[model samples]
Target: MHLLHDRGRPLPAPVPVPRDAAGARRLAAVYAPPPDRVHVRAMMNTTVDGAVSGADGISGSLRNPDDSFAFGVLRALADVILVGARTVREEDYRRPQGRADLLEPSRRPGGGPRPALAILTRTGLLPRTIEPDWPTYLLVPRASREAVVAAGIVPADQVLAADAPADAVARLAEMGHRAIQAEGGPGALGQLVAAGVVDELCFSLTHRTVGGSSSRVLDGPAHEQDWHLASLIVGERATLTRYTRA
Candidate 1:
C-alpha cells in the first residue's frame, strides 16, 4: 500500500541557503528528502565541532528553534517512527501529541495514526513507563519471547526471531508498515545498515566543535556499498546532510 501523504500544492520554498560550511549543513538537513516517496530518515543532531552531546562528553544536544521546526516538518511527513530503547531512555521521549504539531493534521486526527512507535530490544527491556494504549511495539529477539511476555509487551505476530535488524524491518513490513524511520543508538543503525535495509539517512551536523573520539554516524566498519547525497539543508546552528543507499 502507498504510505506517503498526498500533496495538492507546490512544495514550499526550500529552507534558506547557508553562508558557510555550518549553514550549508543546516540547509542540507531540511532539503535532503523529496516531498514524495515512502522514505525513512535517520535524525541525529551534533555539535559544531562534531559531537552528539556534551553531557558525559557526548555531543548530540545542539538544538536551535529553526532546527526544531525543520525536524517537526520531517516528523510530520513520516508514517512511522522507530527508535532504540536506549535512545528513548536517555533522550526523554514523550508520546507523540498528534499530526497537528507535526506537518499533517488529518493523519493525526485523534492524535495520530501518529507515527507508531517501535522500540528495539532483545530481552523486553523497554520501560514500563510508556503508555500502554500508545501505538507502540517492542521488537525483541525470538529467544526473548518469554521475557517480553512476562514484561507485558504484547507479543505480537511481528516478532523478529533473529537478532538481525534487517529481519526486524522485514517483519514490520509483513505486518503492514510500509514506510519506517529509524531513530538510532548506533548499534541498531549498524545492524540495519549491515542488513541492507536503510533507504535514506538524514544527518544533522551542529556548528560547535564537540571534540570527542567516541561514537559516530555508523557504528561499525564502513559498508562497501555506495550512498549518494540526495539533498542538503543548512540551519542556523546545524547542517543536515541527506544520503540515500545507492
Candidate 2:
C-alpha cells in the first residue's frame, strides 16, 4: 500500500507499506478510535462503476489483496463486527478466527475480549450452521424478539432488541463497545447512515468496473451528507480511501 492523496492533496511520491508487525501497528494506529465515546465506522468495497457485487451476488469477487489487508486491520481494531442478516446468509458467514493475533497488545489492554460478531435482523432468521461457540448478538426490534426466541434462531441471551439503529448503537456503547465496525449489506448501511450514527467510512475502490444493476455501497432513500477525504492509499490492485464525517 502507498499514500496517493491526503485530504484531497496529491502526494509527491508513494510511500511503501511495511509488511511486518511494526507495519500492522502503524496501520492500526491510523484507524484507532478515540477514548471518549463510541465510534461507528463502516468498511465497504465497490467497483469503479459503483457496483458492490458481481453477477454472482457476492462481493468477494471484487476484493483484492490490499482490500483484504485493510479489511483485516479494520476487524482487528473493532470491538464488535456488525452485519446484516442478508449478508450473513449470502456470504456464508462464519465466526472470525485468529483475529486476536492481529491486534497489537497495546491496543487491547491485558488481552481484552476478542471482537464479537453482531448481526442485525428484523426477521431473526440466521443460517443453521452458525457456530454456537462464537460470541454473537442479534439486534432486532422489541416486537420481533419474542418471535425470534420462539423460532430458536439464536439463544435468548444473545438477542438484543432495539427500537432503531441509533438505539442499537447506544446499547452497544453502554456495554463498553466503543469501537464498532459495520461490515454491511446495503440496507443495513443505509439504516445506520439514516440514524446519523456513522462517524467514518473506509471504502476500497477496485480498479475494474462492473457495470450492472447490483446494489451500490448504500441503498434505500437518498441521504445527502458531507464527508471530507482523510487519506487515499493507492495499491497495486485498488485504491483504499478513508472519509471522515464532516
Candidate 3:
C-alpha cells in the first residue's frame, strides 16, 4: 500500500496546555483525532547529554517524581500509549494507573486510561504474567503469526512486514489512533522518527549524565534533514524540549 502522507486533509493545530502545578493535578484530557490523522508523540528521559540508558544497562535511573508527574500529564492527554515490546517486558509493566479525571478502571493506577496498550515486536514474545483480560494490542512481523496466536492477543490488521517500523505507524493511524505516544527502547523511537511519523516529542532532560557508548535519539535510518525544535522550557533541575518534523 502506498503510504498516506498528509492524509488528504488538514488537522487542527495542537493546543498547548500551560505548565503549572494545577495543570498537573488535572486529569489530562484524551485526544480524539480525526480518522485519517497519524499523530505521534515520543516521551523519553535523557541525561544532560542525551543517553537514554546508562553503561549499567539500567534505564530506571531516568525517573523522578516530577518527571513522572509530567509523564502522567502527557499520558492523560493521549488516546493510547505505543511502546516496544522490549521496553514493555524489560520494564515488566504489570498494570497501568490513572488519577481522578484520567482514571479508566480497566487500567491500574497512575497508568492513565484504558486506551489500548500497543506493543511492537518482531518475535511476538510476550510475558505470560500479563493477563489477557486487559486491553492490549500487539504489532508483530507477518511471519510471526504462530507466536501471536500462541500469545492469544489480537494482532492488528497491519502486521509489520520487511518494513516493520514503517508499517506499524501507518497501521496505527488506520486503526483510528490519532496521537501515538512512543515510550522507548531508543530503536523503536528512532524508527518512528526515520519514517516521519512522529509529531511532537515531549523530552525530559534530567540533571545528570550517563557518559557511555549508548544510543541517542534518532539512531535509526539517517535523515537527510534535521528535525525542528520548539517550546524550550527550562525547569529547576530539568528541561522540557518539544520537537516536530521539519
TM-score of each: 0.75, 0.91, 0.75
Give the clash count for each candidate. 27, 0, 9
Model 3, CA-based lDDT:
0.61
Taking the tens digit of each residue's C-alpha lDDT, what string does model 1 give over 1-246? 010111222235554453443443443334434434344567666665555666564333566654564555556545557777787677755564322433334232123456667778767665557765766767778788666767665545433454677667766655556557776777677667767778877776766665667467567546777877756555566665667788
For candidate 2, lDDT tens digit of each residue in 1-246? Answer: 777666556778876665455656666766666656788999999988998997788999988877877777667777778899999999887664323457546353213457778889999878987775777888899999898888776688878888889988977776667888888999999989877899999898999887879987888567788998988887778788888898
Best by lDDT: 2
Across 1-246, the per-residue lDDT of candidate 3 in tens digits comes to 011112223225433333454555431322222234557788888888878876667577777655666676666555567888888877775444333444443222223345556788878776875555555667777687566666555544433343466677776656656656788878888887777777777677877887877688656887764556645545545666666656
* RMSD, every candidate, angstroms: 7.2, 2.3, 8.0
Give the range of the ten consecutive residues with the poorest summed lDDT in model 2.
103-112
Cα lDDT, model 3, residue 173: 56
**Angstrom error at residue 188, model 3:** 0.8
Clashes of 2: 0
Report model 1's TM-score to 2 decimal places. 0.75
TM-score-superior candidate, 1 or 2: 2
Residue 224 displacement (Å), model 2? 1.3
